[model samples]
Every structure is written in structure tokens, then in C-alpha cells.
Target: MAKMTLESLRKLRVEQKEAIERRDTGDKSIHIIVGMGTCGIAAGAKEALNVFLGEAYTRKMTNVVVKQTGCMGLCHAEPTVEVKMDGMPDTLYGKVDADVAKKIVEQHLLGGKLVNEHVFDYPARDIHKE
Candidate 1:
């Protein structure tokens, strides 16, 4: 292995700090959670997730936090997305394609309006207890 140089170490430290900053937290005024479980991936969630990240970056949306989570337990509704904004109800959207994801960012994130057609009710599961 090549020995690390002083300049290389400094670059690595900057990258590490940026990665930690990318970790989304609830404290943000607006946050998005993309389901990335096996079922979600098979249904094209990876693209949806990327869309969220890319759009946010393209728009320079600093106040929004984007994160990924495993199996929302709505397998039939694969590619689920959850949006949480301050002073608003937590909204869960199902069957989200890349287009829908973009719409969510525009209508929901930017406009503060939930896409009701994509929103559905899912029974809460106690997966943790299992």
C-alpha cells in the first residue's frame, strides 16, 4: 500500500466531515425518508432516492434533509416515501416513481402541499417487538 501524504490526509478529513453532514436528522425544518429495502429497490426506489438527492442538490435546498430507511413494511406499496416538515403532519406516499418523487419535492417540499393521490393509510406495525 502507498504511504499517506499530508495533503491526502487533509483531503480525507474534509470528505469525512462532509459525509457526516449529509446524515439527515429530524431537527431539520424539512426532511425526507426514502425506503431502500429489498422490495423497494426491486420496484425502482433507488432511482427515486437518487432523484431526491439530485433535485435537492440541483436546487441548493439546504434546509431539507434527505435520508434512507429500510422496509416501511408496505411491500405491496413498494417505493414508499415519507416527508416530514415542521408544523405539518408526517405524510407517507406509496408507489412512488421518479416522476412522483420530483412532484413531491416541488409540490410538497417547495409548495407545502401534500400529494393526496399518492398518499395512503398503512397500518402501523410493531416490527421492533418482533
Candidate 2:
């Protein structure tokens, strides 16, 4: 990658600031990925994804990006959600419902806190590797 010029750096700073504003003064926005494998779909991951999207749009959260992917390899923990923040390590939450999604947005995105009980800190496979 090339080093950013002063002007480019300023542009990046402005973009970051706008993202923070979209997050409502929260330091980092969230990237939410809902697992859509067979198990996950069976467990209602589709509904969870819809809930996140609805919340993002209704709240006008331009910073929060939501997406869908295949299996996370934790069939037991179906309906998984991968949450990524700017500075914090990624976290995966399982068995998510609309209510849980709302709480995640409130407690995690807004308050910058992790919901410990719902976090899946360990996975059998290394999905992060490329």
C-alpha cells in the first residue's frame, strides 16, 4: 500500500469523523455479518439479518454495515453474528433474535461494551485466515 499524502490523510480523517457521527458519537461503527449456512438459516439467521438491517436504516446508522455469509462452522451455534469494530477484536454472537440484535446495537455499538454471555470467543476453525 502507498503512504497517504497530507490531503488524503485529511480526507480519511473527515470520513472517519463522519462515520463516528453516524454512530452517534460512538467511536467505532459495527460490521455485522449474519451466518447464512443451512444450520444458521434453519435457526433463523435470515430474520436476524433483517432485524439488523431494519435497525440500521431506521436509526439512520450510516456507519453500521450489515452483511450475510455462509457457515461459520459452528452449527451448534447457529444464527451466528460476527461483529467487528474499529479498535476492538472481532466477536461472534450466536442464537441471535431481533431482541438480541437490538440489545447488541444498544450495548455494543452505542455503549462500546461487549455482551459477554452472548459472545463466542472461540471457534474450532480459523475463519480469519486467508
Candidate 3:
């Protein structure tokens, strides 16, 4: 066993504190959920998921989090992706492929525009509010 040193203890404490702080204040502003159920995977959800992850990394997008979920009960619309972002309606996009994933990241995430053609569901609101 290695003997404890004061310098080592202090360094460990600092590293732990920084890790805790990062976890506590993650504050990701955008959440992208890809359906990974059997139906989704068969419809190419894996590729879409990879594209999303790759785009986020290649583009250095810090405020976004991409994750996977089980079936959303929209099996007919496999490869669905639900995106939740501040100041925008939570949107579920259907038939998401690699191309659509790129569009979502570029046009929706970056340009703040919905890919209306692929949108399957979203919160209903009065048009007058817009």
C-alpha cells in the first residue's frame, strides 16, 4: 500500500471538487432524445444517433446533450427524435436518418428553425402567439 502524502491528498480533493462542480452545474440547454427500440434500430436509428453525436463533437456544441430512449409508441414512425430546447416547442421528428440528423443539427439546433417536413409531433399552441 502506498503511504498517504499531504500533497497527494490536496490534489485529490481539488480534482474531486472540480468534478462535483461540473456535474452540479452541467446546465445543458438542449436535449436530443433518439428512440433506440427495436423498431427504431431497424429503421436506422443507430446511424442517426451516431450522426448526432458526431455532429455535436465535430461542431463543438457545448450546450447540447444527445441521448437515447426506448420506444416512444410511435412504432410506425420509427427512428424518431425528440428535441427539447429553450424558447422552442418540444418537437418529435419522425423518420430521422443521417441526412435528417444533420439537418436537425444545422438548421434546427444552429439556425433555430424547425425541420417541418420531418416533424411528427409538437405542442399545440395558438398561431396568434407567434
Candidate closest to the true structure, highest TM-score: 1
Query: What TM-score goes with each of the models?
Result: 0.75, 0.73, 0.72
Clashes of 1: 0
Provide the lDDT at 30 for model 1. 78
Flag the better candidate by TM-score, 2 or 3: 2
Question: After superposition, which runs of candidate 2 have C-alpha atoms over 4 Å from their true positions?
Answer: 1-29, 126-130
Listed per candidate, the RMSD to the true structure in angstroms reads: 5.8, 9.0, 8.4
lDDT of 1 by residue, 1-130 (tens): 7999999999987886576578654355678988889999999998898999999877767576789988888888879988988766888899999999999999988887889899966646664123
lDDT of 2 by residue, 19-102 (tens): 766658554557998999899989998888888898887786767889888988877877899999876668889878778888
What's the residue-level lDDT of 27 in candidate 3?
66
Report every candidate's CA lDDT.
Answer: 0.84, 0.82, 0.85
The weakest ten consecutive residues by lDDT in model 2 span 121-130
Clashing pairs in 1: none
- For model 2, what is the C-alpha lDDT against the true structure? 0.82
